[model samples]
Target: MSWKLQSVYMGMTDVATHNVLLLLKSVMRQCANIELNEGGNLLQHSLWVAYQAQAAGCESPLVVAALFHDIGHCLCAGDPELPDYYRDREHAALAATWLSRWFPASVCAPVAMHIDAKRYLATVDPAYRMQLGRGSKQSLENQGGLMTEHELSAFSSHRQHEQALLVRVFDDAPYVGECLPPYTRYERIVRSVMR
Candidate 1:
């Protein structure tokens, strides 16, 4: 038998817990059909990012943000074939806005600026671009083809710049081809930070 969110919900009766459960289920369902070009689906990549965040000693909210940072992709059509401009900013923006319903700025802010962080790294650290896969490079173009010097300076001043950069750093790490810790493992972290 496989682990399931519904199975974990049987004994839970709190309204907030119920809501989170529903959200998790919806995310799982939505991500099931969306496949990434590199391999794996959105949910797996999400879990991996969260796992990396935790391992990197990121604060709880940042870890949660990592888990769902790309959730906007799941929330929308997420079609890679759409056009150059539709690559990821829309998804990042959507995720930040959607996550704001339950999470604080600590969470939403990072999700919102993660793309900018990527652009910052790619432009500021010349060798950084080499680490990205073909898919990420194409997506970066859709995200405005790297940041200008002024954009990087402005982005650095944003209150959550470091947090977003941390999220992006973990997100950019190579996937290890594993299932990741189960969602239930992070429920406490999620509930503790909910608004």
Candidate 2:
């Protein structure tokens, strides 16, 4: 069965473990409803980050952040029937702020800074700036994504910032077919983090 936050929240884990995966799974389900480009699902995005994290030798907190970074977008993409601009300014901050109430600093810190991680790469990594989708680039220039130097500096110091950076990076990677990686991956991550 598809995982739900409420189920895991009431499961055997303590508050800390429950909250992290609960929040992640909630976002995962929300994102699952979104098309990852044309015919893709957001669950693949989460799995991709988890696989990428392990390949890069990352540990628990960063790995966890990688798995849940874009969760905010799924949670707060706003009503589909509403106008595009009829939404919050920063999904990252919204996710982070909500996460801050329960997760460890290592996890929430990167969730909070994931947007800036994108901004910093855009500024410092010319190739990265070039690779952004038209909408993402537009968001960077016109929306609040372009980080001030101070914000960039502050974000650079956070733990697992690199992993968050990877999340931001892979988020734009070619959309694998919807459910390409299957539900099992998401299930494992959710179960693992919760336990």
Candidate 3:
């Protein structure tokens, strides 16, 4: 692993937090080279959700969470196989943990629990399940289907539960967005939030 990443895993110094304004610029720059299946763009999707959070006046941390929520996809990029991320339920956790190195739990927790938020929504809202795209559906199956009673109860009481659910709402948005402004636009937010 790269020294930076290894340091992070070893609980070294890192910071991962910021606001929506900078989100637009940073995400555009960050995601410019990123793309996903179909016509989806990872940064586009992330920015869309982050923008939504911003438009709704969500907290800066949540906006940042929305912006990098699926970073795991990039982290696991180029795997010829399905990757072991799913077998261990590490998809969101991977992103969250990595971000945790640089960010506080306020930001990482929502990213970490986004998938569980999906499962939570599917279990509580039948229409939500029906609306899930094929990929999401497959992932849900891979994520152990709907939340069991115990899982649901535990999730509902989580410290970041509300924020995580909000992140999911943004995550489900269609993958389409314009390039962000500029990284400097919100650099202060990131600097202030970093550990």
Candidate 4:
């Protein structure tokens, strides 16, 4: 049951939920082959984040956001024509845009803002910048360095700001060690959140 975005956008609501879930599974499987800088693949990273969110008592939307936050990395990496910096900066927004059609703003907004949340954390917490992995540090630079005070203030006003920060925290912690339920364990949880 592979799904394409074109078919999804063509009023295929009847199967959209199932198809979207299938697409997520497909992407997670694809992530196994793509190495992340944190010493694991995107699938592991996503699962780690999802598990951390659930452990923290985050709501379903936030957990879903955590799982899919880095999916943009897989999506953007597929385009050979795009530069690395473009891929780094655009992945979050790309994931968010695609997700918005199927998910509520609660889910999509954090996915969209997670990158900014990274930048925001760097601004507010001096120790946070040093905690970023090598790739994340590079992407942080590519993402306009740390957010300025004004930018941070504006970002804080978003309704999902706290959830975005929590997702960011989970995103940062996965590099420490392999932990929690396996990747497949999240399939049911993710599917439950699909509209």
Q: Highest TM-score among the candidates is held by which one? A: 4
Full-model lDDT, candidate 1:
0.84
lDDT of each: 0.84, 0.65, 0.75, 0.84
**Deviation in angstroms for 186 in model 4?**
2.3
Write one digit per residue (lDDT tens) for candidate 2, span 1-195. Answer: 447876786574566565665665666777877665434566667667666665677766666677777666677665576444323246667677776665576766677676777788887788988878777776676446666788778778876677678777666566544334543454554444432
For each candidate in turn, give its C-alpha RMSD to the true structure in angstroms: 7.1, 6.8, 7.6, 5.6
Candidate 1 accuracy as TM-score: 0.85
TM-score of 3: 0.76
Which candidate, 1 or 3, would have the higher lDDT against the true structure?
1
Better of 2 and 3 by lDDT: 3
Worst-scoring 10-residue span by lDDT in model 2: 82-91
Better of 2 and 3 by TM-score: 3
In model 1, the runs with Cα more than 4 Å from the true position are 1-17, 78-84
Supply the global lDDT for candidate 3. Answer: 0.75
Better of 3 and 4 by lDDT: 4
- Candidate 3 — which residues are off by over 4 angstroms? 1-34, 81-89, 175-186
lDDT of 1 by residue, 1-195 (tens): 345766566445367666876786678668767888888888788888999999889899999999888888877765657554674658899888888878899999999999999999999887999888888898898888789879988999999999999999888888977668976788788888887
Q: Candidate 4 lDDT (Cα, whole model)? A: 0.84
lDDT score of residue 133 within candidate 4: 71
Error of 2 at 189 (Å): 5.3
Superposition TM-score, candidate 2 onto the true structure: 0.70
| TM-score on alpha carbons, each prediction | 0.85, 0.70, 0.76, 0.87
